[model samples]
Target: MTALTTLGLGPLIPLGEALPPPEVAWRLALVGVGMGLHGGPTQALVLGAAPPGRAATAASTLQLSRPLGFALGPVPAAAVWGLAGQAHGVRAGIAFAATAAGPAVPLLTLRRQPSTTAG
Candidate 1:
């Protein structure tokens, strides 16, 4: 169930572009559920791996990277969007995003060493 829901977000842009307004509106209801299933696990993995009492701080740091990456990640794609068009831009953007995801994944997949208390 969760994996299916998570995977459904894979088609967000193309589905939105393909469907009529009514269908898009109806499918919009499923968007949150799908994203929650996908993103919740991701966020949990980030927060869960943080040290006690400092988890929130660390999570903030992790989330900060998100917006920072938005600026950093899509520069080339945005330039392409300006010069080329949305379709090419979006394709480039996705490829860039996937490349970014590749490096962070290994970092996040480290063995769960027990977190030491600061006290």
Candidate 2:
């Protein structure tokens, strides 16, 4: 669900160019909603799945990855934008972002195995 919402962002962003200010604002708000829906469940899943004694490490790693992803995500997008040329740069970059989300779809289908340790 979260991946699908994120996948929608790339196509939605470019539409802002042709949309009025109010329309763009609402779409951006929707993006925020999508992000909010993903964040908590993701954190919970990570924390819940951590080894019994490694919750702190799992949490810290998760925190670190968020910023790293944010910082690194644009690198490829920018490269795509540059390669595409100014005329279509923004759209190409956004399209690249959409493609990047593709892998998450399959990943989301994975189920966590039941813990072998007895309570």
Candidate 3:
């Protein structure tokens, strides 16, 4: 589900280019939906995979990373927007976002390996 949503988002966002305000709003809304759909499940998987006594540490690390990602994720897009000028900035930003999301799909879909520790 996470991989699917992430994959869909890459193309869906860029398709908003040159669209009217309402159309763009819908695309952004879908992006929000996609993020929301994956967020909880991803967090659960991260926490679940944590070693027995380290759940709190895992949770804290996850919490910290979320804000850090939110803050930094837009930097490249913003840089592109600034460099490309207003006429093309929006499209450039969208392209940057799509490009960034593309690689994440495979990572999201990767199978977890079995634990090797002696039981």
After superposition of all CA atoms, the RMSD between model 1 and the true structure is 6.0
Can you give the TM-score per candidate against the true fold?
Answer: 0.43, 0.77, 0.80
Candidate 2 accuracy as lDDT: 0.73
- In candidate 2, what are the lDDT values of residues 16-109, reduced to their tens digit? 2365767556655755676667767778889988987999999999899977987998899889988989677767876787777667767866
lDDT of 3: 0.73
Q: Residues 1-119, candidate 3, lDDT per residue (tens digit)? A: 44444454455545534667776666666677777777787789888789889999998999899789879988998898789897778778778877787777778767677689787
TM-score of candidate 2 to 2 decimals: 0.77
For model 3, the superposed segments whose C-alpha errors exceed 4 Å read 1-17
Q: Give the lDDT of residue 118 in candidate 3.
A: 80
Better of 2 and 3 by TM-score: 3
Of the candidates numbered 1 and 2, which has the greater TM-score value? 2
lDDT of each: 0.54, 0.73, 0.73
